[model samples]
Target: MAAAIKLASDRGVSAIELVFARNLFSLPVVATWLTLAPGWRAVRTRRPLAHLSRAGLGLGSMTLNFIALAMLPLADATTIGFSAPLFATILSALVLREKVGRHRWLAVAIGLAGVAVAMRPGGASLPAAGLAIALAGALGTGAVNITLRQIGRTEGVAATVFWFTVISLAVSGLGLPFFAGSHDWQLWALLVLIGVSGGCVQICNTASLRLAPVAVVVPFDYLQLLWAMLFGWVLWATVPGPATLAGGGLIVASGLYTVWRERQLHRSHLPATPTEL
Candidate 1:
C-alpha cells in the first residue's frame, strides 16, 4: 500500500484521489462478500452514528498516512504509524473507561519516547510535516480503535467493514474532481493494485485475529517494519537512517511490551489452575 501510494504520488496522483481509488477498489470486494455470503442483512446496523464516526476516522487515518507516505521514506512513515497502538491505549482509557494499569501506562510513555527518539528532534533531516501527519494519523487510528470497540459491541464485523468502505469512498470521491491526476496504463494498474492489496491485507489481518489468540498473532505485525525496510531498500534504494532505525527499534519494543502486558493481564484473569493452588 505504501509503495503504491508513493508511486501514485510520484506519478502526480493526489492523496485524495489515491485514497478514493483504494476505497473504490475495496467497495466491490465488500459488496461481493455481502452478495455471496451474508447478503444485505449482514450490513444492517442500529448504530449509524457510531459507524459514521469510525468511517470518518478511518478516512482521516488513511488519507494522512498516504500523505505521509508521499513525504517520508517508506520505513519511517510505516514505523511512525505503528504508534497507533500507543494512541489506542490512551483512547481506550478515556473513551472506553477501561482501566489502564501502571505497567501499561509506563509502556505508553515508553512508546511515545520511542517516537521522539525516531524523530531525532533538532536534527537537520527532520521532515516536520511528514512526521506531524504521521503522528496525527496514528491518533486518528486510536480514535478508530475506540469507535470500533463501541461499534463492535452491537455491530457485526461485516457491517462495520462495509460502512467504513462506503463512507471512505463517498468522502474521497467527492474530492476526486478537484484532486484527481492523470494516470497512464502503468500508473492506473498501480492504483488498482493499491486497492486490491489493501483489501487483501485487511482480510488477512482480520482472519488472523479471529483464528488465533490475538497475543499470539499480533507480535508478528511488528514484522511490517522489517518488510517496510526491505521494500524501502529494494524499491527505492532508501536505507533507514540512524534516527529511523533507532526510533523504529524503540517503537517495536514498546509495542511488544504493551502486548506482553495485555497478555499478562489476560492470564491473570483466567480461572486459577489446581496446580497453582
Candidate 2:
C-alpha cells in the first residue's frame, strides 16, 4: 500500500484520483468474483443502509489516510494511524455497549500518550495538517470497525467486500469531474497494480475477521508499522526519528496488552471442560 501511494504521488495523482482509480479498476474484478463464486445474489443484503454508512466512512478514511501519506513521512503516518485500534476500543464501549475493564482503559490512555509523543508538540518535524488528517482517518476507521462487527453477524465476507467496493466506486467516481486527468501507460499499469493488491488486502483482512475474534487478530496489524518504515527508507530515504520509534513502541505495546487482556477475559468466561474423575 505504501508503494502504491508513492507511485500515485510520483504520477502526480491527487489522493481522490488515486482512490477513484483503485475503485474503478477493482469493481469489475470484485463483481466477477462475486458472480462466479457465490453468484450475483451474494451482493444482496438486508442492510443496505448499514453497508452504505460503512462504505461512506471507509471512503473518507481512505482518502484522509492517503492524503496524509502523500504529505507526511510514511513512518509518521503509519505510526499515528495505529491509533485506530485504540479508537475502536473506545467506540466499542460507546456504540456496542461493551464493557471495558479498567486495565483496557489504562492501556488506551497509554496508547494515546504514545500518539501524543509521536506528534512531538511544538516540533518543526511534524506536519500539523498531515497529522490531524491521519488522526481523523483513524477515527473514521474505528467507526468502520464497529459497523463491520455489527453487519458481519449476518453478512458474508463476499457481500461485505462487494457492497463496500460498489459504494466506494460510486462516491469516488463523483470526484472524477474535478480530479480527472490523464496518466501515461506506466502510471496506468501501476494504478491497476494498486487496485488489485488493495483488493487482495481487503480480502485477507475480511477473512481474518471472519475466522477469529477481532481481539485475536487485530494485534498482528501493527506489522504495518514495520512495513511502512521499510518502504519509507527504501523508496523515499525517509528514516524513523526518535519520536516515531518511542511513541510507536508505546502504542504497539499498549495495543498488544489490550488484546491479551481481552483474550484472558474471554477465556475466564468460557465454560470449562473436565475429564478428571
Candidate 3:
C-alpha cells in the first residue's frame, strides 16, 4: 500500500486524487467480487445507514493517513498510526459494550505514553501537523474497527467491502473538478495495481473480522511498521531513530498482549464464511 502511495505521489497525484484513483479503478475489481459472490444479491443490506456510516469513517481514515504519510517520515507516521488499536480497545468497551479488563486499560495508558514518546514534545525536527493528522486518522480507524465488528455480525464481507468502495467513490468524486489532469499509460497501469491491491486488502480485512473478534486480529497491524521501515530505507535511505524504535516496540507489545488474552478467551476459526457471524 505504501508502495502504491509512493508511486501515485511520484506521478504527481495529490492525496485526495490518489484516494479518488484508488476507488475509481477499484470499481472493476469490486464489481467482479460482487458478481462472483452473486451480483447485486450479495450486496442487499438491511442496514444502508450503517454501511454509509462505515464509508464516511473509512474515507476519513484513508485521507488523513495518506496526508500524514506525505508529510512525515514513513517510519514515524506508521508508529503513530499504531495508536489505532489502543483506540479500538477503548471504543470496543464504550461503543460495543464489550468487557475490557484492567490489563487492557493499563495497556492503553502505556500506548499513549508510547505515542508521547514518539511525538517527542517540542521536537523541532518532526512536523506537528503530520503527527496531529495521523493521530486523528488512527482514532477514526479505531471507530471504523468497532463499526466493522458491529456490522460484520449480519453483513457478508462481500457486501461490506463493496458498499464502502462505492460510497467512497461518490464522496471523493466531488474533488475531481479541482484535481482534474492527465496521466500517461504508465500512471494508468500503476492506478490499476493500486486499485486491485487495495480491493484485496479490504477483502482480507473484512474477512478477518468476520472470523475473529477485533482484539484478536488487530495485532497483525503492527506489521505495517516493518513494511514502512523497509520501504523507507530501501526506497528513501531512511532509518528510524531511537525514539521511533522504542515507541513502536511499546505499541506492538500492547497489541500482542491483547491478542494473547483474546485467544485465551476464544479460539477463532478461519473458514471462508463463518457460521457464527
Instruction: Tell me the number of clashing residue pairs for each predicted model.
Output: 0, 0, 0
- Compared with the true structure, all predictions reach lDDT values of 0.79, 0.83, 0.85
TM-score for all predictions? Answer: 0.90, 0.91, 0.90
The segments of candidate 2 whose C-alpha lies over 4 angstroms from its true place after superposition are 35-37, 210-213, 266-277
Q: Per-residue alpha-carbon lDDT of model 1 for 125-207, expressed as tens digits? A: 75899889989988886677666667766777778888888888888889888988677899989989888888766555544
Model 2, span 122-224: residue lDDT tens: 8757779989999998888777777777778889888899989888988898888898788888888878877887787776777677676544465577889
Q: Which stretch of 10 consecutive residues in model 3 shows the poorest summed lDDT? A: 264-273
Model 1 accuracy (lDDT, Cα) = 0.79
Tell me the tens digit of each residue's lDDT in model 3 across 166-234: 999999989888986788888778777877888878888888987876766787899999999998998
Reference-based TM-score, model 1: 0.90
lDDT of 2: 0.83
Indicate which candidate wins on lDDT. Answer: 3
**Model 1 off-target regions past 4 Å?**
203-221, 272-277
lDDT of 3 at 59: 96
In terms of TM-score, which candidate is strongest? Answer: 2
**How many pairs of residues in model 3 come into backbone collision?**
0
